[model samples]
Target: MNLIKYTSIAAIFVSTSLIIAKILTYHFSHSIAILSSLVDSSLDLLTSLINCVAIFYAAKPKDEDHKFGHSAIEDIASFIQAMIIFISGILIIYQASMNIVNHKVITFEKVSMYTMLLSLFMTICLVLLQKYTISKTKSLVISADCLHYKTDVLMNIGIIASLFILKFTHFYAIDSIVAICIAVYIIYSAFELGKSAFNNLMGREISRQEQDEIIAIIQAENRIKGFHDFKTRRSGQMSFIQIHIEMKGDLTLFTAHEICEEIEQKITEKIPNCEIIIHKDPC
Candidate 1:
C-alpha cells in the first residue's frame, strides 16, 4: 500500500495547513507560545517530504551501481531531517528571547485559543495514524517521522496551555517561558534523530536478541558441530549476518551442502528480509 509514502503525503498537507493557521493565529494574538509551535511545525513539511522520498528510494531494488539496494538513503534522509529540526528549534529560541527581552505582552482571544485547540486535535489524530503506519512498515524513516510527530503532539499541548494561561491569568511572561521550553524540547528531539541516523549509517550491530535467535536456529540443525565468528550489521530494515560453522571432516560433500542449505532456510524462516552467509570449516 506504500503506507509510509501515503502517510508522508498526508503529513505534509496537515503540517502545511496547520503551520499557516498557527502563523495567522500568532499574527493576531502575538503569542510566542503559538509562534514556537509554528516554528516546530514549519519543519514538518520538509521532514515529511524527506521521509516520503527516502523510503521510496530505499525500497528500490538492487541495481548495477548499487548492489546493496538503496536502503542507506533512509538514514541520510533522517540526518537531513534532524538538521532542519535543529535549525527550527534555534529559531524558536531566538524569537522567544526577543519577546522576553522586550517584555512583550501578549493577549489571546477566544479565536486564537480555539485555533490552537483545533491544531492539537488534528495533531493527535495524525500521531495515532503514524503509530499504526510504523507498526506495519517498521521503516526507519517512517519511525523517525512518527517519533517527531509524537513530540509535535506534546508541543501543541504546551502551546494550548500557554494560551489558556495568558487568556485567564494575564501573566504575559508565561507564554515566552512555555515557548522556550518547547524550543529546548525540539532541540532534544533533533539530537535523538541525529544520533539514531548516525548509528545506522555507521553500520550498528543488530540487537543481541536477534543475533541469539540466529545462533539458536543454526545450532538446532542436525550434524552442525558448532558455530563461531558470528557477526551482524544492520542498515535500515535489512540485517546482515555472517558466521562460520565447524562440521565433521569425514562428511560427504553432498551432505555438507545439504546441511548448509537447511541452516539457510531455517534462518530465513525465522527472520524475514535478512541476508545471511555461512562459511563451513571441516574439523
Candidate 2:
C-alpha cells in the first residue's frame, strides 16, 4: 500500500481502539469527563472510517471522470472530517453545560483515570506516527489525522487535570468549564482545517519558497531569456506546474526541445513527484 493508505489504516486502528477503550472506561466509572472523551473518540472513529474510504478513492488514477486526478478527494475528505469535529465540539459544549447546570459530580475511579491516561498515551503515539508519515509523504489527509490526535492530546490533558481538581476540591463546575474550553479549541481547529482544505480545493498557489526555487532554476539556464504565465496547483502528492519560457529566436526547434527537457529534469529533481510543462516562446 501507498503511504496514504498505510497511514490511514493505522489511524483507523488507533481510533477504533480508542473508541472501544473509552466505552469501557465510561461503563466502569460513568464519569462526565470520560463521557466527554468517549464523544470525541466516537467521532474520531467515524471520521477515520470515512478517511480510509476517501483515501482509497483519492488514490485512484485519473479517469475520464476525473481528468485532474482523484487527489482533490483528500481535501474533500479533510473538510468532512473537520465538519464532524465541529459537530462533536458543539455537542460536547452542550453536554458539558447541562452537566454543570445540573451540578452533576463526576466520579473518577482508578479504572477510569488509568484508562483515560492510557488512551492519551496511545493517542500521543499515533500522533507521532502520523507526523512522521506526513513529513515523508506530505499527505493532507494524514496530516489532518495527526491534527485530530494532537487536539485529543490537549483535551485528554485538560480532562485529566479537571478530574483531579474536581476530585480534590469537590468543585464539579471545573469539569464542565474544562470541557467547554476543549470544545472551543476543537471548533477553532476545525475552522482552520476546513479553511485550509477549502483553499486547496479552490486552487491555491504553491508556496512562495517553492515558486522562488522554480524561478531560480529556470533563470539559471542561459538559454532561457525569461519566463511568464507561470501556474501551479496540487492534488495529493502530485503537483502540476506550467510556465512560458522565452528563448532566443535563433534557437532551433530541436535545441528548444532539449532545453525544455533539461528544465523539466531540473524541476523534477528539485521537487519530487512534480509534473512540469513548458511553453516555449521565441524572444
Candidate 3:
C-alpha cells in the first residue's frame, strides 16, 4: 500500500511539473505540435490527480456497509480518466485540423525543443518508477497512470522531432500533420485503457494461467476427491477466488474443515494477497 501511495504522489508531481513546462513552451513556440504535447501533458496532470485520490480511497478497509472494500473505485477513476483522454484527443485533432486549413505560420526557438527534451527525460524516469511499482503492487490506478505517462513519452518525442524538422525545412504544414498523428495515437491509447478498466468493472475473471495454478493446487490435495464451481475475479490489487471441494461423506465435520483450511493455505501461498472461499461438499 505504501508503494502504491508513494508512486501515485510521485506521478502527480511529475505530471504537474510537465504541464507547467509545456504551457510555457507552447506559449512561445506557437506550434500546433507543441500544443499537442501541451494538451497531453495537461490531461496527464488531470489523470494523475484523479489517480492519487482513487489510490487513497481504494486503500480503505472494508466496512459493514461495503463488504467488498473500496478497491473498485480505482476502476471507476480509470474509466473517467479514459473518457477525459478520449475527449482531449478529439480536441487536439480539431485544433490541428484548423491549423492545417488556415495554413497558419508557426514559429519556435531552441527553448521549445529543450522543453520537450526535458519532458521526455522526466517522463522516462517516472515511467521506470511506475513500472517498478506496478510489478510490486499490481495496482490498477497506478497502472492506468503509467499508461498515461507512456503515451506522453511518445508525444514528447513526436513534438521534439516536429520542432527540429520545422526548424530545418520550415514546411509549416508538418506541424499540424504531426499533431494529428499524435492525436490519433492518443485516442488509440484511450481506447485501450478504457477497455481494460471496463473489463474489471464488469467483473472479468482472472487470467487463465492463474486459474490453472489454482486448479493444480487444489488437485495436489489427495484427501479431496474433486473440485468444482471455481470462480475468480479481480478488484484493484485484490483477487477473490471461490471454489467447492469434494471429500468423503463419512469424514467428521472438523476433519472436513481442517482439510479446507489446508487447501486455503496452499492457495494463499500460491497467490499472494488473494481472498479464497472454499465450500466443502460430500463426494
Compare the candidates by TM-score and give the number of the best one: 3
Which residue pairs does candidate 2 place in steric collision? none
Alpha-carbon shift of residue 241 in model 1 (angstroms): 2.0
lDDT of 1 by residue, 100-152 (tens): 89999887677677887888888888888888887786655666677788877
Worst 10 residues of 1 by lDDT: 137-146
Candidate 2, which segments miss by more than 4 Å at Cα?
Answer: none
Q: CA shift at 142, candidate 2, in angstroms?
A: 1.9
User: Cα lDDT of model 3 overall?
Assistant: 0.85
Q: What are the RMSDs of all candidates, in order?
A: 2.3, 2.1, 1.9
Estimated TM-score for each candidate:
0.89, 0.90, 0.92
- Model 2 has an lDDT value of 0.82
Enumerate residue pairs that collide in model 3.
none
lDDT string for model 3 (1-283, tens) is 8998888788878878888887887788788888888788777778788888887897788999889898888788878888988999999999999988998999858888898899999999999999999898776567767877887787788878888888899989989999999999889988987897898889999889889988998888899999989999987667899999999999999999998888788877777768889998898
Off by over 4 Å in 3: 252-255
Cα error, candidate 3, residue 235 (Å) = 2.3
Where in model 1 is the C-alpha error above 4 Å? 250-272
